[model samples]
Target chain A: MKIAVDAMGGDFAPLEIVLGSIEAIRENPHMEVVLVGDEQQIFTILKENNEQKNPRITVHHASEVIGMDEHPAQALRKKKDASVVVATALVKDKQCDAVIAPGSTGAAVAAALFGLGRIKGIDRPTIATPIPTVNGVTVMLDSGANANSKPKHLVQGALMGSEYAKLLLGKANPTVGLLSIGEEASKGNEVVLATYPFLKKLKTISFYGNVEGRDIPKGTVDVVVCDGFVGNVVLKFAEGLVTAVTQLVKDGIMAGGIFAKLGALLVKPAIKKIGKRLDHTENGGAPLLGVNGVFIICHGSSKAKEIKTAINIAGDLVDRKIIEHIQKTIEVEGAFKYEYDE
Target chain B: MKIAVDAMGGDFAPLEIVLGSIEAIRENPHMEVVLVGDEQQIFTILKENNEQKNPRITVHHASEVIGMDEHPAQALRKKKDASVVVATALVKDKQCDAVIAPGSTGAAVAAALFGLGRIKGIDRPTIATPIPTVNGVTVMLDSGANANSKPKHLVQGALMGSEYAKLLLGKANPTVGLLSIGEEASKGNEVVLATYPFLKKLKTISFYGNVEGRDIPKGTVDVVVCDGFVGNVVLKFAEGLVTAVTQLVKDGIMAGGIFAKLGALLVKPAIKKIGKRLDHTENGGAPLLGVNGVFIICHGSSKAKEIKTAINIAGDLVDRKIIEHIQKTIEVEGAFKYEYDE
Candidate 1:
C-alpha cells in the first residue's frame, strides 16, 4: 500500500517526518511512503538518516507550505502546490491509497474536503478520535471537523463511528451513543434531541441511548457521537484533565518528605506503566472519516514514533477497507438527507 | 437570612437533607432554614438527628415530590407543592433569601426559572458552575441551563460570569474567555464566533479572546463562557476524566508488589491533599445565575457534607448580592438582543 505524507506540516517538520517515513517503510516491507514537501529539505533529512537509498521511500516536491494559522479553506484554494494539498491531490489521483498529515487540523480537513471530497452518501466528513477508556478505546466522532452540524450529520457521524469501531478497533457490533448531558431520551441540546429518535430507528447500528460525559472514560458505548463543537471540547478537556492529574500527582509526590522520595523510587515501574497508557504517542492519529479517501490527522507536536504509528494505522485502514465499510453504512441507511440551513 | 431547603429532592433526601440543614443552622447563628417537604418525613429525620427543637430550623409542608426523571418545567408547573418548587416559591415570596436543592439540575433550573423568573434584561437563566483549577475556580456559565442560546445570551452569560467571579471567588477583574476549539478569533461554532465581537466590545467585562477546553484546568481565564451544550459536556467530561485517572492510579498501585503497596501508604496523605483540591464538594454547588432569586443546585447524589457546602454557597451568593450584579451587568450592557429564530 502507498501513502502520501505531508512532511512540512508539523512543528518538528521535515526531520521527524522523514525519519518516521523511513521507520514505517522499514517496519512494513509492503508499505511505501511518498513524502510531499520541499525537495532540498526532504533530501537533506533523508541523507542524514541514511535513508536516501531506500527504495520504499520517495520524495515528491511541492512548492509551498500552508502556515498553521492560515485560513484552511482559503489556504487550500490559494496554495495549490502546498505540501498537504499536493499530498491530498495524490489521494485524489489514485497515486496513493491514503493521505496523512501532522498539520493544522483545519488545513488537513479542508484539503480532504476540497481535494478528496465527501463520499456519495455522506453529508459531512468527521474527525473520529480514539479516546482511551478504562477497558480500551472509544471512537468519538465529529471531533471538530465541522463547526456546524445538522442532526443528520450527527447521525452520519454515529454510523461512521460505528464502522470505525468495528474495522479499526475490532469491536463487534459496536454500541453507538449520542453524547448528551443526561442518560434519558429527553436530555440534551436541540441537535442531540433531534438526532436521538433518528438514531433509535436506525437498523444498522446497536444504538444505545444518551451517554453522559463521564461515560466516555467508563466506556459506556463503543461509539460516541456529537457535533464538532461539543466533541472537540470533550476531546480536549480529557487531554487537559489527564495532564492536570499527572502534574498534581507529581507535585504531591515531590512535596512529601523523604519517605515520599523512597516511595517514588519503589513505584517508578508502576508509574511508567500508567504513563505509557496515557501517552499520546502510544495511540496513532485520528482518522478523518466519511471522506472519499483515507486521511489521518496527527497532533502537531507528534514525534517520529507517533508518525510511524499513524502510518501503521493508515495501512491498517486500507487493509480493512474502512472507507468502503463507511460507504456501505451510509448506503444501508439509505443516505437520507436531513438538511439544515448552514 | 432565611434559606429554603428541598427536603425531598436528592437520592438521600429527607435523611441527609434534614441533617445538613440542621448542621447549617447550627453553624450560622444569623442563618435560618425553612425545610420544604413532607412535614412527617422531615420531623422523623429531625427527631432521629435529635434536632426537633432547633429554633433556627423550621419546616414547611409540601406534599408532592418531583421524581428525579420527571419533566423539569412540567413537573414544576404540575407539582405546585413539590419540595423544590415550594422551596423556590419561598424565595419568590420574599420569605427566604435563597433556595438550595440537591436534585435534578433541570428541575432546579426549571423551578428557579418558573418560580423567581429571570432577572430583568436576562433572556434565559444560566447555571454558573465553578470548575476547580490549579490556581482557583474558573466560573463557567450556561452549564446546561438552556439547550439553545442566542449569541446575545452568551454575551450576557460572560458578563454574569465575570460578576460571579468578582463577588463570589473574589477575583478583582476576572478575565472572561469564549470557550472554543482554538484561541484564534475565527475559531469555534457559529454562536461562539458571533459572540466574539460582542464580547470584545463589552466594557463591563475583561474580555480575553478564545480559550480551549485545556485552558479550563490550566486556569487560563477566570470566567469561561460557552453555550449550555458545550459547557455541560466540558464539565461532565472533566469529572469523568478525573475519575478515570484516579481509578487507573489505584489499579496500578494495587497491581504492583509489596513495595508499591508501601509506596501507596507513604503518598496517601499528599494524595489526599491534592484530592481535596480537586474535590467538587469542597467547591460548593453551582449557582443557577440570571434568576431573580438565589438558587444553588447540588449533585443528586450529594451527601450531608456536600449539602452543607451548598448551603454555605447559597448564603454567600445572597450575601454578595449576585442577582443585583447580574441585573447591573445587563443594564450596563444596554440589554441588547441578538435575535435568533427560537
Candidate 2:
C-alpha cells in the first residue's frame, strides 16, 4: 500500500511530516510514502536523517501551502497546487490508497470534499474523532467538518461512525448513541429530537436510546453521533479542560512546600502515564469519513510519532475496505428513505 | 432575611438539607431558614442533630415531593404542594427572601418559572452556573433551562448573564461571549449567527464576540452564553471527563506495582487539592436567572457543604438584588430592539 503525506500542512511542517513518513515506511516495509511539499525542503530534511536515497520514500513537488488560518473552501479553490490539495489529489488519482493531512482541519475537510468527493447517498462528510474513555475509546462524528447539519446528515454520520468503530476499535456490533442533553428520547434540541426516531428505526447499527455528554467519557456507547457544531465544541472543551486541570495539579504541588515537590518527583512517572492515557495524540488523527477516499486529519501541532500512527491507521482503514462497507450499509439500509423529518 | 429550603429534595434529603440550613443560620446570625418539607421528617432530622429547638430554623409542612425522574413541568402542575414548589412559593409570596432547591434541576427550573414567573422582557429563564477555571470562575448560562432558544432569548441571556457576573462574580464590566463552534463572528449555527450581531450591538454588556468551548475552561470570557441544550451537554461532558481522567490516574498508579503505590501515597495531598479546586460543589448551586424572585438550583447529589454554600449564594443574590438589576438592564438597553433576525 502507498500513502500520501501533506508535508507542508502542520506547524512543524515538512520536517516533522518527513520524519513521520520515513518512520512509518521503516516500520512497515510492505508500504511506501509519497511526501507532497517543496522538493528541496523535503530532500534537505531527508538528507539530515540520512534517508535521502531511500527507495520507499518519494517527494512530490507542490509550490503552494494553505495556512492554518485560511478559509477552507476558498483556500482550496485558490491554491490548486497547495500541498494538502495535491496530497489528496494523489489519493483521488489512485496513486496512493490513503492521504494524511496534519494541518488546519478546515483545509483537510475542504480538500477531501473537493478532491475525493462524497460517497453515494451521503449528504455530508464527518470528522470522526476517537476520544479517550475510561474503558477504552468512543468515536464521535462530525467533530468539525460542517458547521451546520440537517437531521439526515446526522443519520448518515451514525452509520459511518459505526462502521469506523467496527473496523478500528474491533467491535463486532458497536452501539451507536445520539448525543443530547438528556437520556430521554424527547429531551434534546430540535435537531436531536428529529434525529432520534430515525436512529431508532435504523437496522444497520445497534441504536442506544439517547446518551448525554457524560456518557461519552464513561464509554456508554461505542459511536456518538451529532452535528458538527456541538461535537466540535465538546472536543475542544475537553482538550482545554485536560490542559487546565493538569496545570492546576502542577500549581498545587508547587504551593505545597518541600514535601510536595519531593512527592511530585516520585509520582512523575505515574502522572506521565495518566497524561499519555488521556492524550489525543495516542489515538493519532481523526478520519474524515464519508469522503470517497481515505483521508485522516491530524492536529496541527502533532509531532512525528502521532503522524506515524496516523499513517498506520490510514493503512488499516484502506486494508479493511471501510469505504466499501459504509457504501454497502447506506445502500442496503436505505437510510434516507426513513423520511422522519417533515 | 429569611430563606426557604426544599428539605425533601436532594438525594440525602431532610438530613443534609436541614443540616445545611442549620449551618447557614448558625454562620449568618442575621438570617432565618424555613425548611419546607414533611413536618415529621424535618423535625426528626433536626431533633437528631439537636437543632429542633433552634429559634432561627422553622419547618413549613409540604406534603408532596417531586422525584428526580418525574417529568418536570407535568409533575409541578399535578403536585401543587411539592417541596420545591412550596419552597419557591415562599419566595413568591414574599414570606422568604430567596429559595434553595437541591433537587431535580428540571423541577427547580419549573418551580421557578411557575411560582416566581419570568422577569418582564425575558422570554426564558436561564440557569447561570459557575464553573471553576484555572484562574477563578467562568459563569455559563442557559445550562439546561430552555432546550430550544430563539436568537432574541440569547440576547436577553447575555444581558442577564452580564448582570449576574457583575453582582455575583464582582466584575465591574463583565465581558459576555456567545458560545459557538469558532471564535469568528460568522461561525455558529443559525441561532448563534443571529445572536452574534445583537450581542455586538448591545450597550449593556461588554460583548467579547464569539468564544469556542475551550474558552470556558481557559477563562477567555467572564460569561459564556449558549442555548440550554449545548450548554447542558458541555457541562455534563466536562464533569464526566474530569471523573474519568481522575480514575485513569488512579488506575495507572495501581497497575504500576509497589513503587507506584508508594508514590501515590506521597502525592495524595497534591492530587486531593486539585480535585478540591475542580469540585463543582465548592461553587454551590446554579442561580435560575431572569426569574422575578431569587431562586437557586443545587445539584441532586449535593451534600451538606454544597447545600450550605448554595444557601449563602441565595443570600448574596437576594442582597445584590440581581433580578432588579437584570430587569433594569433589559428595559434601559431595550435589548430586543436590535431586530437582527429576519
Candidate 3:
C-alpha cells in the first residue's frame, strides 16, 4: 500500500516528516511512501541522515505549502500545488492508498473534504479521537474539526464514531453517547435533548444516553460525540493536563535530593510508557472520518515520532479497510443542515 | 456572627467538621458557631476534641440527617428536622449569619432553595466557585447548581460571578466571559448563542465575549458564566484533572530509584503548591449566591482542612454581606427563566 505524506504541513515540516517517513518505511517493509513537498528540502534531509531513497519511499514534489492562518478553503483553491492538497489528491486519484498530513488542521480538513470528498450519508466528516481513560481509550468525535454542528451533524458524529470504534478499536457494539450537561433525557440544551431520542431509537451501536464532561476522563462511554468546539476543549484540556503533569514529575526528579532522585530512577520506564500512551503527539494523529477516503491528521507541533505514528496509522487504516467497513455498516439518515449566519 | 455548621456532613464529618470548627473559631475569635446534627454524635466528637465547643461555638442538634443517593427534595421534606434543614433554618431565622454544609450537594441546594429562598430577580442561585489558575483565581458560577439552565440563568450566573469576583477577589471590574467552545461571538450551542448578545449588552461587569475550556486554567477572565451542566462538568473536570495529575506524579516519584529520587525533589515543592492551589478542597466551598443569605456548599468529601477553609469562606461571605450585594446589584434586572415542561 502507498501513503502520501504532507512534508510541508507541520511545524517541523520536511525534516521531521522525512525522518518519520523513512522510519515508518523501516518499520513496515511492505509499505511505500510519497513525500509531498519541496523536493530539494526533502532530499537534503534524507542525505543529511545518510538515508537512501528507494522505490518503496519516493518524493512527490509540490511547490507551495499552506500557512497556518490562511483561510483553508481559499488557500486550497488558490494554491492547487500546495503540499497538503497535492497529497490528498494523490489519495483521491488512487496514486496512494491513504493521505496523511500534520499541517494546518483547517487546510488538511479542507483538502480531504474537497479532494477525497465526503463519505455517503455523512454530511460532515468528523475527526474521531480515542481519548485515554482509566478503563482504556474512549472514542470522542469531531475533536476540533467543525466548530459549529447541527443536531443532524451530531447524529452523524455518533454514527461515524461508532463505525470508527467498531473498526479500529474492535468494539463489537460500541456504546455511543451524546456529550451533554446531564444524563436526563429532558436535560441539556435544545440540541442535546433533540439528539437523545434519535440516538435512543437507533439500532446501530449500543446508544448509551448522554455523557457529561467528567464522564470523558472516567472512560464512561465507548464513544462520546459533540461538536468540534466542546471536543476541542475536552481534547486540549486532557492533553494540557497530561503534558503539564509529565513535565512536573520530570522537573521534580531533576531537582530533588538524593533519595527523591533514587526514587525517580526506580520507575522512570513505566512512567514514560504511561506518558507515551497519553501523548497525542504519538497517537498517530486524529483521523478525519466521514471523508470518502482515509485521512489521518497529526497536530501542527508534532515532530518525527508523531509523523511516523500517523504514517503507521494510515497503513493500518488501509489494511483494515475502515472506510469500506464504515460505509457498509453505519447508515446515517435524514441528515439536516445547520445553516449558521456565518 | 453565628455560623451554623452541619456537624454530620462530609465524609469525615463530626470528626473533621469538629476539628475544622475548632480551628475556625480559634482563628476567628469574634465568630460563634452552631453545630447542627444528631446530639449524641456531635457531643461525642466535640468531647473527644474538647476544643471546638466554646461559649461562642454552640450546638443546635437535630434528630435526623439526609443520606447520599436519596432525592434532595424528598429528603428535605421527610427530614425536616434533618441536620441540613435545621442548619439552613438557622440562617433563615437569622439565628446564624450563614449556613455551611460540606454535605450532599443536591441536599444543600435543596435546603438553600427551600429555607432561605431565591433572592428577588435571581431566577436560579449560582454555586459560584473561585478556582485557582496559573495566572490567579477565576470565579466560575452555576457550577452544577441547576443542570438545565436557560439563557437567563447564564445571565444570572454572570451577575453573581461578577459580584463575587469584585466583592471577594477584589477585582474592580472583573472581566466576565461566557464559556463557549471558542472565543468567537458566534460559537457554542444554541443557549450560548442566545446568551451571547444579551451579555454584550450587560451593564454590570466587563463582559469579554466568549472563552474556551483551556482558558479557564489560564485565568483569562475574572468571572466565567455558563449553565449548570457545563459549569458542573468544567468544575468537576478541572478538579479531577488536578487530582489525577497529583496521583500520577506521586506514582511517578515512587517508581524511581536514587537518581530519579534526587531529581523528584527539585520540583516537589512547586508541584505540591500547584496541586494544593488546584485542590478544590483548599478553595473552600462553593457559595450558593443569589439566595436570601450566605449559604456555602462544601464538597461531600470535605476533610478537616477543607472544612476550616470553608468556614473561613463563610465568615468572609457573611462579613462581605454577599447576599445583600447580589440583591442590590442584580435584583433590578430580573434574571431570565425558562418555562420547562417538567
Winning candidate number (TM-score)? 2
- Place model 2 in a CAPRI quality band: medium
lDDT of each: 0.87, 0.90, 0.79
Backbone clashes for every candidate come to: 0, 0, 39
Accuracy of chain B in candidate 3 (TM-score)? 0.94
Every model's DockQ, to 2 decimals?
A: 0.72, 0.75, 0.29
Listed in order, each prediction's TM-score against the native is 0.97, 0.98, 0.85
lDDT tens digits, residue span A1-342, model 2: 999999998899988889989899899988899999999999999999999998998899999999988888889889999999999999999999999999899889889998999999898899999998999889999899876778899999999999999998898899999999888887888889999888888889999979999999999999999889889999999989987887888888888877778877877788788788788888889999999999999999988888999999999999999999999999988986767564
Error of 1 at A223 (Å): 0.6
When only the first chain is scored, the TM-scores of the models are 0.97, 0.98, 0.92
What tens digits encode model 3's per-residue C-alpha lDDT throughout B41-77?
A: 7778778877544697787889888876567788888
Q: Please, what are the lDDT tens digits per residue for candidate 3 over residues A262-314?
A: 65555566467667656776577889998988899888887888888888888
The TM-score measured for candidate 3 stands at 0.85
- The best-first sequence of candidates by TM-score reads 2, 1, 3
The regions of model 3 sitting more than 4 angstroms off are A37-53, A58-65, A71-82, A146-156, A170-215, A218-222, A243-271, A331-342, B51-53, B61-64, B73-82, B148-152, B184-204, B207-209, B242-274, B328-342
Q: Summarize candidate 1's per-residue lDDT along A1-342 as a digit string, tens digits.
A: 999999998899988888888899999999999999999999998888898988888899999998888999888879999999999999999999999899799999989998998988787899998888887888888888987888889888888899889986787899998999889998888888888988987878999999988888888889999899888887787777778777887888889888887887887787788778878777768999988999999988878898999999999999999989987877788746644333
